[model samples]
Target chain A: MNSYPVTLKQSYSSALQAYLADAQEAALMRAYELGRQATENGLGVLDIAAVHQEALTQVLRPSSPSQETLQTVQAASKFLAECIAPFEMTHRGFREANAALKQQATQLANLNKELDAFAYSVSHDLRAPLRAIDGFSQALLEDYLDKLDAQGVDYLNRVRNASQAMGRLIDGLLKLSRLTRAEMRRQPVDLSATAQAIAEALRKSQPERRVAFSIAGGVTANGDPVLLQVVLENLLSNAWKFTSRHATATIEFGATWQDGKQVCFVRDDGAGFEMAYAGKLFGAFQRLHGRNDFEGTGIGLATVRRIIDQHGGRVWAEGAVDRGAAFYFTLEP
Target chain B: MNEKAILLVEDNPDDEALTLRALKRNKILNEIVVARDGAEALDYLFGTSVISGQDAPLNPEIVLLDLKLPKLDGHEVLKRIRADPRTKLLPVVILTSSTEDEDVVKAYGLGANSYVRKPVDFDQFSEAVRHLGLYWLVLNVPPRSKGR
Candidate 1:
């Protein structure tokens, strides 16, 4: 029952009065001006309709002759239609903006694909020069072991080590970039089996690392098996690596029902990170520990996040400074 | 001991030299023939290089093929090798960087005997070269020369 904007109400009343006074084209012209003013005042179609109805009710006399009332009603309808001209124009404006937005989206997608191809080509070619550097450094060491002093040999070895480190970086970045470009195949994958297999392989790779894995059996998920495997590999390997200092540690993997959806988590009792820097943990090349304490390219969690995101899931981490770290993800429809 | 030459189809001079050094250090004493491009490799195998005045093809005991090259890349060379009856059975081992590379899968599909990822660490790479030499040259017997 509250009145509309006072200025809109006043202008609408005057416009109707002028229309009734002569029913001339000039009087109706004021109706269009009223619409533009209404829009400027942030009045919508509903507000304008309210204003028109109230103005017409006041202009009509209940005691008027039927003939005069009919004429007044017809004139009032025409004025209302004219007053909504700005609303129609607003609709057309939205449609055109939407079309432009869609076109730009398509252009952006094409540009992203081109960027991906360029990055892939660059990463592919980068390996050759890196390999040559390492190979030549090795050649220097093997071919001239006795001719050079220990310091020279050490320098050559260092060169080889640096090149190999770059190789690892390139590999990590390549894998990271390809996550988006690769075609994903969704299937019913036995996550437990994949986790067990990864655990077995990790143990085989370094048998001296004492760690116990507690993985739930029959854990399945509908996703791209190859991609899910990558997620588990990165997460589990992170757990295995961070726990290297402990004589014995525990790593757990399983899923649980959280708010009626399946949430999977990987947890390890290892050298955990601070809650303050937890946000930076999933960023590429963002490391929390020094290289001397831990060896990683800081790509593992980022890889996990990307794959989970591709699967329409969310991933997050929780940890303290020294207790341990736990990563959780949810896959839902 | 296999006396035939080993054809190395490589475009990068650094890779070519490194492969030579790796194989030589591993006691792969077979004569190593270098072809700098895919076309040159095809030329050596088909013996069609009239400019070089070679009339007969010298079949290598094994071909260490790289994926990327200047002309006719590795897959094209592999296809031609399989297409021709003379060199169809030639044992070609692919040298790649990583298993993640899809090119390795395509290489396997094109009838490669084995693939060795070239590790950036020199010692690991040397070990890989040694294993390849041991597997192909010493342990496994080469197919009898086909009426050459």
Candidate 2:
């Protein structure tokens, strides 16, 4: 592209100069002089100064370099070098500008990732207290509403309801943030011990419930502890919560090897959700049961799904309304 | 006989109140000496020019250092404490709100004996204080004291 432009400009200017030097064609010579002045003043079709000396030599003599032509070549070379200097500088500047723009784009992407992580951490950390506040407040209102005057009871109930809704909003925000921030760490996790601890805690929460809770031992997998805990917590908490309706609530937390991958499941016998809405089970704020029937922020399953994805794993649920729900998750080998 | 002393270095009033309440609730029977900022903590620790009117020369069994503080930060205070032979190996425990891994690693690197993340919830916060006081005061044996 560069060589062709230089050649064309040289040819065009050489033709004009030839016309200017002609004796018989005085009118054409006058026209050529006028065109040359206009070109010098930046009023013509091209800048003659920009043409290369080699291109001028090609226009003057199509073949061979000569001793007499050397002076003309040098003059042409000087003019061409002067004209091309600014453009070369400009081209270099443009390259630097483009590189800077690319660097800024990378920095912006990094900042966005950090912001997502910050939002996730904040939301998750904040919810623990909000849980204690909302849960305990509701318990207070439900268990001791009669001792207080009407207005006082109403105020406490309002506080409880508002906090519960805030909990839902917080949970949703946390899931959205976790979609970007959550990263997978693969390490061998003793699933049996984790399940047993969760089961014992659940049973301790309700001693008289008479639930036959069983967790198979020796189940292990490689995954991020925090994310895997989220999966287990959600699944086991769901199982424990749902099975509250049964007189003999039976729940099992275990893992089985399926197709060379560890497949963990939390199986329960209680108010299981319908299979029709199973597709929406992992969606944020998508609740299978009514708020009155089941107490949930509805962000649990969404978190479970996100954590599994971070591990490059998969999650699914199977259940029939009023029978039971079983959530299955798989981790990399 | 030296009355057992604890140097509580904290900035925020609410946090200070919460911490004091937590300590008291956990039956930490030591005479608690409070420093509102890092400068004050230093003054009490090293007997700075601002607080030279010593009723007695100050020496605390344990310094509960909070990482973030106004004026001089927790790091500066820690450096000052560790620099002097009198207070070197004084069993500093960093108690802070931040759970950032860098801070954890840095605190331990700076010769802090233990690092405890300050829990946000009231009950949990109090429980952590209880365990902390019990562990530092009764369980872990302090090095033999140098003559004052």
In model 2, which runs have C-alpha deviations exceeding 4 angstroms? A1-112, A120-230, A252-264, A274-299, A330-333, B26-29, B49-57, B100-102, B138-140
Instruction: List the TM values for chain B, per candidate.
Output: 0.91, 0.92
lDDT of 1 by residue, B1-148 (tens): 4388888888889888888888888888999889888899989988885423596776888999988788798889998998898898899998865455578788888898888777777778889989988888889887776786
Candidate 2, A22-130: lDDT as tens digits = 6357646654665565434433232434343444655566456586786777676786677677875675677679889999989987997888777756764575555
Residue pairs with backbone atoms closer than 3 Å in model 1 (clashes)? none
B88-109, model 2: which lDDT tens digit per residue?
A: 8798989886555667788787
Give candidate 1 misplaced runs (Cα > 4 Å). A1-105, A203-210, A216-219, A256-260, B50-53, B98-102
Name the weakest run of 10 consecutive residues (lDDT summed) in model 2 chain A: A43-52
Residue B118 displacement in candidate 2 (angstroms): 3.2
**Against the true structure, whose DockQ is highest?**
1
